[model samples]
Target: MQIFARNLTGRTLTLSCDKSTRIESIKDQIYTADNEDGNGISPPQQRIIYGGRQLCDSRTIEDYNIQQFSTLHVTGSLSGGELVYKFIVVVFSIAFGVPILKYVYRQYVSKLIESATESIANAQKRATERVSGAGRRVTNNRLSGRFK
Candidate 1:
């Protein structure tokens, strides 16, 4: 699969990601993770204060299934006096749009080339026919004049 995006600078962008990914589970793992406040949350099922709200301890994320995998993407931009998350939309759009645009462009170019080739062939055919007819007419005129 292919992906495309328009960068903030109006430049072309491309990104690729595998269909399958592997992620470790939050279980049996230690996290000194800080949330921009010099604070760390560890273990699952722990209640911690976040965004000025009291939340359950479900902060630990873990993957234990040998065949299970997860994807984590992060993107942010500082604008409008706040940061906005735009990673998901960008990733999803590029993941599906690039291939489509590529296919459409290929088809369009193929059609153009076909049309040009056909036009050239027809023109060559007409020119050949005209030359042949003119040759025959000149020969006939010469023969008639000789006979007279």
Candidate 2:
């Protein structure tokens, strides 16, 4: 069957492939064709896509019901290391990000509550001292009033 294959750079080519051909084999062929005589740059790994679905390396054209002249998109696939890095990033963003932010907010709120309570206690102490001082002054005046 004839298939229209396009590389990442939008270069189109027509290739002959049998329905029983594994998708992996087709990728190797394209890679080989791309490097024909080791002349041009080629990607380290590949991802084959057709009909908006990623074609599996172990699957055949017939398995995907790929028709003749169907367009296959060729692009670079992430390496194992890159995939791991991406996974780590996603995991941290979900698992650690929210909790860290919440912890910081909790710290601020706790400090605010503590400061408010301390201020209130200080004000009450001052009020008590003022009342006691006034009572002492009145008592002193009464003691001298008997002499006057």
Candidate 3:
């Protein structure tokens, strides 16, 4: 099984382990890959959780029902679950924000189109009136000249 492990330091590793391999050995592999200057964390001290369940050393990855490409969270210490809350909040904000922004944009475009249409119609009306008035003036001038 392929598992993606992420540490609290934001270091991640894509590890391949046999389905029968125990969680304890997986933690050892991660520890070996990034021992990094006497961090002093043993595999037992590192807490690994997957899918909301704390993984135990005695259980195999398959026994815990962990699947391929599953994320394993390894934290040196426990926080107040702030990361989970932030992820939910951001997702909801984007879901609610997109339609509102799209509606505002559509309203703005419709107003612009309406104003342009009105301006064009008014200009056409004025040009038609001017042409008709000029033709009438020319016809009257010709008639009066012939009578004189």
Encode model 3's per-residue lDDT on 42-85: one tens digit a residue: 78678897888788888998898888888899876455797886
Off by over 4 Å in 1: 1-98, 133-148
By TM-score, rank the candidates, best first: 2, 3, 1
Worst 10 residues of 2 by lDDT: 132-141
Candidate 3, TM-score vs. the true structure?
A: 0.48
Give the total clashing residue pairs for model 3.
Answer: 0
- Model 1's alpha-carbon lDDT is 0.37
lDDT of model 1 at position 131: 49
TM-score to native of every candidate shown: 0.26, 0.50, 0.48
Q: After superposition, how far is residue 58 of candidate 2 from its true place, in Å?
A: 0.6
Least accurate 10 contiguous residues by lDDT in model 3: 132-141
TM-score quality measure for candidate 1:
0.26
In Å, residue 114's CA in model 3 sits off its true spot by 62
Deviation in Å, model 1, residue 66 alpha carbon: 80
Error of 3 at 87 (Å): 37
Q: What's the CA error at residue 88 for candidate 2, in Å?
A: 17
